[model samples]
Target chain A: MSIVKRVEANDSWYMPAIFKGLGITFKNMVLNLVGKREMITLNYPEEKYEYSPRFKGSHILTVKKDGSIRCTACMLCATYCPAECITIKAAESEDPTVEKFPISYEIDTLRCVYCGFCEEACPVDAVRMGPEWQMPGINGANFVYDIKQLARRPQLKGGIVSVVDEEERHKAGI
Target chain B: MVSLKQSLKSFLQKLDNKSRSIYFLTQGCCSIEVDNLCSSNYDLQRLGYTIDIDDPREATVLIVSGWINPAFAEKIKEVYSQISGDKAVIAVGACSISKSPYVDENGLKLTDVLPVDIYVPGCPPRPEAIIEAIRLLEKTKENRETSKIIYGAIRELG
Candidate 1:
């Protein structure tokens, strides 16, 4: 059981409390006006809060050094996705070494949960969670990002090269 | 005379922009993020956006957040019809835009009922994205022809 102390309420008791509250408010106002304390509000457009590298904002399809897409159309990402937003149409690759490549890779941005499962499921590091989050559009059609938009959008420059080496993976002999 | 008329029009536009009020429809989890936008951290009021909760008629912008059921669709249409003067509708989050995680076969999309000016795509888009969408809406309102052309060119390039 907790102890309770009885205190008498008086007309004089409220005055000191009111003055103390006002004093604190006035002090804060003066401090803010004089620029003595930093404001918590972020001037959004001018100054953006940088999220960490692991932040799952948007998807980016990585490319090879030769400016080709890195995705091998393994279907692991599509299987793992809870929302099933990713659609990959696999086609036979022309290269003797490579087996298959996605003829069409589309992600319905409006349906995506940004769960980052696709990034983790990829064995080749073909998919990554990019830093960009702003993807507002005027139409529903624009929300469906195709392979070209995912990999070779102007914002990503030419393409983001995968850090993982194919030779290193083969040498590991999984 | 033409220059003077243009100047007066621009002045009126600026005044209209300043007096714009927003009516936000809270439907799901996305409403929480929209609520965050009004707080001191985001401070949407600084951008001349006032949330009008009492009257839909007074709102110049309607922010539709989250999934809309068939029952709410009729109510949304009624509210949309009630809103007077120049109005813009914003669809915030994946649910509002495409009704994600919900089967589309029976889903009632916001776009089918009302024309959307901006589509902010995310499970629950960050407040920054919503702000950017509002800014884009304002820009389009200011110069529709030029902005459309620019936006089209950018889209084509992408």
Candidate 2:
């Protein structure tokens, strides 16, 4: 346990170790300059890196055929949210065919874990995790997206509708 | 005194020379992901945008990211105050835009404290979106300078 290596003159000067480090750096610099080394660095802004097919990002509430929010105010998404960030204030739907509708639906992006549980819990495929990854804001209040904001999201094709929990899918013929 | 056109030309030149030196004020978890913008994949440095963590005074842009509760609000205000008037503020996350679930009635947003130039809304907006927001800001900035020059010239001629 009390073993100690004897220090040499070369170790004190450290010229050889410094040269070795410099040699590796110069080699890399030359290799990179000549395009011999593989370039892993992506030119961002000009270049875009693709995410996985099943990537989950921001939330978007789907619209029906009439362009109205498809949400039936089932409360399944709110119930399933582990973060409890989704708030849906349900009201009686004007249409007699529908039971209830979310008068005010908001998702706190800060608290959202981006877990697809809410999507999976949805029966009507009303809510979706959009492919939009960017969500920068200047104020905190803007993060709490309202019903209009969610409903207004552009329909990104091949987006996640719902996974796992689709009990009512067979009945609805979706 | 310099002529109106000469002053206007110099003003435009000065505005163009101002590099977007950003100072990131990260508060919560979401900022961790936003840090990926500096990595190899979405290298923001290549675009001449630098994050000066040591000094806010030199920064031309302030990127406010993550959740800002009452406590974080005070620190943000201090940082914002340190930055000069000739600067743009970009809010990067939903939490910075509004009070997240963690905050109550006393929670204060970055907007209430400082003027925001751009708002990129997402839970954690992608690096691409952030870049787009900045690009939009740059375009607007140039347009604003051009309009100012024209207005100044018109006033001088009148």
Per-residue CA lDDT of candidate 1, range A1-174, in tens?
998867768654899889989999999999999999789888888889888887788889999888889999999999898888999999998898677999999998888988788998999999998989857877544778899889998889899999877667778874
Worst lDDT window (10 residues) for model 1 chain B? B146-155
- Which CAPRI tier for candidate 1? medium
Off by over 4 Å in 1: A1-21, B1-10, B102-106, B142-158
RMSD of each: 5.9, 5.9
TM-score, model 1, chain B versus true chain B? 0.79
DockQ of each: 0.53, 0.36
Superposition error at B3 for model 2 (Å)? 24
Q: What is the lDDT of residue A62 in candidate 2?
A: 78
lDDT of 2 by residue, A59-152 (tens): 7887665566778898999988876889989999777766788889998775676778898998777887776674544333376788767777
Cα error of candidate 1 at position B113, Å: 2.4
Q: Please give the fraction of native interface contacts (Cα pairs under 8 Å between A and B) kept by each candidate.
A: 0.64, 0.51
Instruction: Tell me how candidate 1 scores on lDDT.
Output: 0.82
lDDT of 2 at A80: 82
Task: Give model 2's TM-score versus the native structure.
Answer: 0.70
